[model samples]
Target: MTFNFLSPVSDEVLAHNELLTPQALGKKLKIHSKAHGLPDLDNVKIAIIGVLENRNDINYMGSEVELDSIRKVFYNLFPGNWYTNVADLGDILKGDAVGDTYFALRTTITILLEKKIIPVILGGSQDLTYPNYRAYDSICPMVNVVSVDSNFDLGDSTLPIKNNSYLGKIILEQPYNLFNYSTIGYQTYFNSQEEIDLMEKLYFEAYRLGEVSKSISLVEPVMRDAHIVSVDLKAIKASEVSKEQKYSPNGLDGKEICAIARYAGISNKVSSFGVYEYQHSKDDHITAMLVAQIIWYFIEGVNCRVSENVLSDSVNYQKYNVLIDDDELIFYKSKKTGRWWIEIPFLPDVNNKLKKHTLLPCMHEDYLEATQGKIPERWYKAYKKNSF
Candidate 1:
């Protein structure tokens, strides 16, 4: 079992946990430690797993990746008024080979998915997202991925898998389960024009940093439709993280990133969440606290999730129809949550990947735009992807 590959939380962290206030999350969580083998996962809503593999990082030198700092901070902080049970499964130590580590992570995440427990992954490098995405292969037929990143990371699929190029592997690899991929807070200058053009050509979604920061709520719908939400810490601005952790001067702030994490947690479709690109440094306290708060807010959002009877009953939602450019567009709004969804027309001629997800999550603005005879870009992209 891949769980056997997992090492217990360090005695140091456990000792620190004992000193934390009773109200702290450390006291509330079912922790995996030397004393306790594995926590009973019954009714457990979330599982935290730390990955200690960063050799895949293109800039790798021979340094080790440690997650104890983040764990110490996260456990010391107080949780919100949450009823959902959380478990810290400790860390997945690096294996004999990078592929071995990926296998361990992939199997672990797959088991967690089968049990209907969300795996909140604290990862060393962003490439671990490939395994996270792979874990969904057996659980779901089609998957939507949302990345909170500054670059597309669609490097050469022809090359070996690395943090910057893992997306290409996900795209070209067998089974072709990726239905849609969306990126939030992407910096235009960081991405090559070819990659940007490829994103548009493939009908994938990419939101710029300024646009998302201007209105953080814009990510709600995008996140609502996502199955795997991967966040890269490098997407955060230099001012928000430690000196060694900063990869860009222009990126999302701490608040913006946390808000995005909350949105990801609130999404019913989002089953796996990961924050990657963590670098241990002498002054990592700020970054650790920020990451901890991000996790906390995610838990709070999950607890606050409102179950909206989206398409079951007509009485539960209000339906609207708009004619744009001689084509009829259908939209539905949940009366209970006031959330909107635009229907993706079924293409009988083509094998559709989104048949189960016919009602694509959207915003009120999308309906208003359609009413004005303008096709919302998201709707257009979905429609095009479905047609192909």
Candidate 2:
């Protein structure tokens, strides 16, 4: 009944799949249709939806649905060993008001997450991430978001919400469920100094585009700690997506974006993911396929998911205690995945939201940095945030 608000993928668009081979994804996954109604939700694992709203975007305007074109390429690629039943639930058509579309997305995604169905959203504008973030309000007491974008999107929350500044809405709005916000691939020139200072001031994390490109693995730890991952397509280079807003000669190339997507999907905590800021084009097959491949990598990462599905057994981990500036730091290394995590001790005096994870995910390098008598920035941030 939650899907009552959704419409099926247009048959006219689906007809394009006649060109697909039997092994193509078009023939493998179940799809929502006018005839078959919705896909079998009983066995469904991931639900894909296209949002048709973009009026709030200052950088881009109008509703240009690109999901069908993206699907033309997505359904043709052979899936990896992914056994999850992925359903294409069609598009959330644009409403009379942008806020109406936001309501639809928020309610629909909230239902999906409650059903344990992860939503893979194809967006009309990056502002859709606001509703995507809102969807988790009923499900999670505290949510952490990891955004892969060239800019922070932290516009003035006091003003009307726009794609360029919806994050400010998320940060300033009521119910204050956001525990951590980490932005990957933020280019310095695109963000104001005040935004950069605000990130540190709030204990939020922001990585420069160059730093992430140098070590793509740096995102895995960040992703491992996220519940929602929002991606702005412009973070990718213009060569990959010609219609990209603020298309730049320099950005995360195709391979890097795909790698980041994979990390997002592989995260134990990341439940819902979205790729936004897409526009329809006359010759967008290449861009469509590139988005499809980025999605493919995300699904591939979901397939490669380990440790998260299984309960963490203490026997499978090695624990170490290190003292840094009198405050003892505890670390755990997962023998199975070689992933590291640092523990945050409970200070009863301080209100903490990390009751579920006193031991947050970390990189081995964080442990090494701590061993050198220097507190890792991540640990310090987490400590500072939790202490308050």
Q: Name the best candidate (by lDDT).
A: 1
lDDT of 1 by residue, 1-388 (tens): 4477788999999999999999999999999989879989999999999999999999999988988999999999988889999999999999999999999999999999999999999988999999999988899988999999998999999999999999999999998999999999999999999999999999999999999999999999999999999999999999999988988888999889899989988988889999999998875799999999999988888897888766778888999999987788999999888899988888777876655548889999989888888998998999899887
Stretches > 4 Å off in candidate 2: 60-63, 243-246, 308-312
Tell me the lDDT of candidate 2: 0.85
Per-candidate RMSD, Å: 1.1, 1.7
Worst 10 residues of 1 by lDDT: 348-357
lDDT for 142 (candidate 1): 88
Tens-place lDDT per residue, model 2, 1-388, is: 4676688888866787767888888887788888888887877878889887888878554446657888888998998888787889988988888888989999999989989988999988888998999998889988999999999999899999998898999999988999999999988999999999999999999999989989999999999999999998888877777564437777898899999999988886889999988777777777788889988888888878885422367888888999877799989988888988888777777677655447778899999988999888888898899877
Quote the positional error of residue 306 for candidate 1 in Å. 1.4
Give the TM-score comparing model 2 with the true structure, all chains together. 0.96
**Clash number by candidate, in order:** 0, 0
lDDT of candidate 1 at residue 326, scale 0 to 100: 76
> lDDT of each structure?
0.92, 0.85
TM-score of each: 0.98, 0.96
